[model samples]
Target: MPSESFVASRLTSGNRLFPTVVEVTDSAVIRRRRTLFSRSEESIHLQRIASVRIETGLIWSDLIIESTGGSDPITSHGHHKADAVRIRDLVTAAQTAHLPAATEAGPSRACPFCAETIKLTARVCRFCNREV
Candidate 1:
């Protein structure tokens, strides 16, 4: 049973030990960065996602995926804005699809404020920070 996966480009040469990349799997979201002699990866399980926030800048964007069970969030920085947005959409879709039936209100609807897809019952738009 193959699953869905999203990975960023890792071919940017000439950047020293900071060969960082973003990965999103059916089960988790991952951020990996490597240095001269060390490499680190942060992962956030899809089922544990409590909230996701993205901060967009002119040149780069930051992604933060907070967990529901009190674990540290998986954060990735300096990614292209498009990539950050894509990550958020993927994670949100996965969460909505995997959530327990008891917690699901119904099919999700588009947020009127920002037009970004969000849960049908959501009162706040995560992308535009507006009332839904």
Candidate 2:
């Protein structure tokens, strides 16, 4: 379903004002309205996320979403603590649900002799040259 799970902005005049919003969705985390000069949205797929970090303040919080690819983390500042927490939890759950290839469920089996990945019908471990 469509969602407006969070809106983070630069707070001014001691009040909450949302100039931009971070959208949480089933498959992606999107930050819309990045600049006035151009319409740009940053979207991070759930499968690529490495971690979601929240830094809390007295009245506001910041979120840093890191990727597994070693690129720069997406940062959203001036979010409410509850909003930040919700975003963190949502991202974490999505990341766990959408794991990468190394952790993906498959038909391959582990070789008992060398603990290497092997086909289900394999009789020998190719990497270790041992009987499976």
Candidate 3:
């Protein structure tokens, strides 16, 4: 899936020069911060994200994305409340989409046409080269 970006509002403190940008994608969340002399970025994979915390103010919101590895959390503030919420939602949706499928259905099954053992999730038979 395509990535969605949220930028902190410049009106808030510490963002008057270069606002922070947060990007959420199917595989990871990235935060980009810029300064007069340098730029920095932080990223956490979807599977490694532990939680998302949002602190809402009257107008803007703060976002904190914690990692399961006990590393530093990715944080950005001064974003619109709606954008902050959307970022959390997108992270949740992406994590769910990235989860591995259950194997309770069985690992392998016989292909009806080829009578060959194949993965349960396979749509085509490798032995017969036909759709199953």
Candidate 4:
């Protein structure tokens, strides 16, 4: 069996260091298996993988796997629990950075008499014809 450190290194490497085969079942579950240099084989179950992209190199194998599921497989430097925590943190960070913030930012304006909300750029309220 390959050492845990070796497995982790292969996984975290941005470039494809292993040949990965992803199997997607009818139920949308994904099973990812990677064989590195024919010496190490690691498998990870990713709940739902919508798509996969693989880049093969002459000398090194590069694989990138994306999942549409709620979370990704956890990789840790320590125990399994630590790996879970690390994965959760990584997922959370990715989600936080993935979302686009609202383009418009300003105080919300409501007509005093009509109780209608109006956009900051709006000259008149669509719901109630109130000049801002």
Task: Give the winner by lDDT.
Answer: 3
Candidate 2 versus truth, CA RMSD in Å, comes to 5.4
**Which portions of model 1 miss their true places by more than 4 Å?**
1-17, 101-132
Every candidate's CA RMSD = 10.8, 5.4, 10.3, 13.9
Instruction: For candidate 3, write residues 90-117 as lDDT tens digits.
Output: 9988887878876575699999997999
lDDT of 2 by residue, 15-126 (tens): 2443557888988888765453566678787777888899887887877888887777787778888988888788777666666547544578988877788888777788
Predicted structure 3: lDDT? 0.93
In angstroms, how far off is 116's CA in candidate 1?
Answer: 32
Candidates 2 and 3, the one with greater TM-score = 3
User: Against the hidden reference, what TM-scores do the models get?
Assistant: 0.63, 0.63, 0.75, 0.29
Candidate 1: count of backbone clashes, pairs at least 3 residues apart or interchain: 0
Candidate 4 — what's its lDDT? 0.40
lDDT rank, highest first? 3, 2, 1, 4
Query: Which candidate wins on TM-score?
Result: 3
Q: Tens digit of lDDT per residue, candidate 1, span 86-118?
A: 888888888888876675556788888777888
RMSD of 4: 13.9
Instruction: Flag regions of model 2 displaced more than 4 Å.
Output: 9-18, 99-132
Task: Supply candidate 1's per-residue lDDT for 32.
Answer: 75
